[model samples]
Target: MEMLIVVAIIAILIAIAIPTFASSLNKARIATDEANIRAGYADVMVNVLLDDNYDAENGNASTAGQTKYYLQKDGSVATTDTNAYKTQGKNDSATTEIAGQKVGAWAKDKKVTYQYDNTKNQAVISFE
Candidate 1:
């Protein structure tokens, strides 16, 4: 029957659309994480400029004299917690690692990772 054929075609169309929609959603989350990393880098630079003796090893920019700066969603300086953006690896290495806790829903247990180079002051974002 024509009705049965039409229903089958509609179902196929929906199946195709579902995957595309999910892919787009995942890409959006990745983009958001990238933006957050860039913002954190900028905040750190600002703190470095403000405090002449800011010590990056202390990891407490808001407390004065610390070189490292943590960023919040509202763009305020965070003194303690860096849960939103987790820093990994060593700054002295060729690549310092940064990670975002909340990844795309489709990524399941995987977290988004970024490799930062202090020499060039650049970050390379990745999902893993």
Candidate 2:
């Protein structure tokens, strides 16, 4: 009888722990995604500053007078299209590539979107 009670308590503890662990993991992923978006925006801004005629509307492509930016798995920048960004989260349906580089993985329920505001000369990253 005593052994049965102990087993039941252990089972209850396991059930409680599993969901908490899952939640924490999800939070971590969200934080990472936010950081990636911020970093990518910053890199684009730097490129704009360096070029005298950086046109946000046409700067992301590889054509003449346009700059090429490559997104990697960790959300870092690369000069070439070697390691494009791949989705790492629940939303595998969303496109991981933005402009020319890999953005971070977005969650299915909380989708992430990016756009270049030509009038403001800024990159906007938002979650919806």
Candidate 3:
């Protein structure tokens, strides 16, 4: 009889722990997505600075560069690609890229809701 009771208790514990563990894992995924986005944005900023320097030396009218991880234009980051970035400066259209992969809903809300703050300049990312 005691053995049966022990098994039942273990079963209950497993049931209770599974959902919590799953939820925590989901949260971790969201956190990782946020961090990736922020890193991409930082890369974009750096690319912009580099492009500006290149333009200064080459005397080229075009001052922009785009890749899978960064974008730059006219000495600063470009925020005009809706497919890439959305909602710039709070009132602008969603036209930008985070890490060159196009911003998603989680990145658009500024990570204030179900989303995560993916902006490198405005958000913070930590690892487990």
TM-score for each prediction?
0.54, 0.61, 0.46
Please report the candidate that would top TM-score against the real structure: 2
lDDT of 2 at 68: 46
Off by over 4 Å in 2: 55-70, 78-82, 90-105, 108-115, 126-128
> Alpha carbon lDDT of residue 3, candidate 3?
100
Per-residue lDDT tens digits of candidate 3, residues 1-128? 99999999999999999999976765665555445456545655455445543353433323333222312222222333323322222212244344434443443234221111323222121111
Backbone clash tally for model 1?
Answer: 1
Candidate 2 has its poorest 10 consecutive residues by lDDT at 59-68
lDDT of each: 0.48, 0.56, 0.41
Regarding lDDT, does 1 or 2 come out ahead?
A: 2
Off by over 4 Å in 3: 53-62, 65-128
Question: Per-prediction RMSD in angstroms?
Answer: 8.8, 7.0, 11.6
* Reference-based TM-score, model 1: 0.54
Instruction: Report the lDDT tens digits of candidate 2 across residue range 1-128.
Output: 99999999999999999999987876666556656666766776665556655545654422212444554556665556455554344534345554445554455444333444545556555444
lDDT assessment of candidate 1 = 0.48
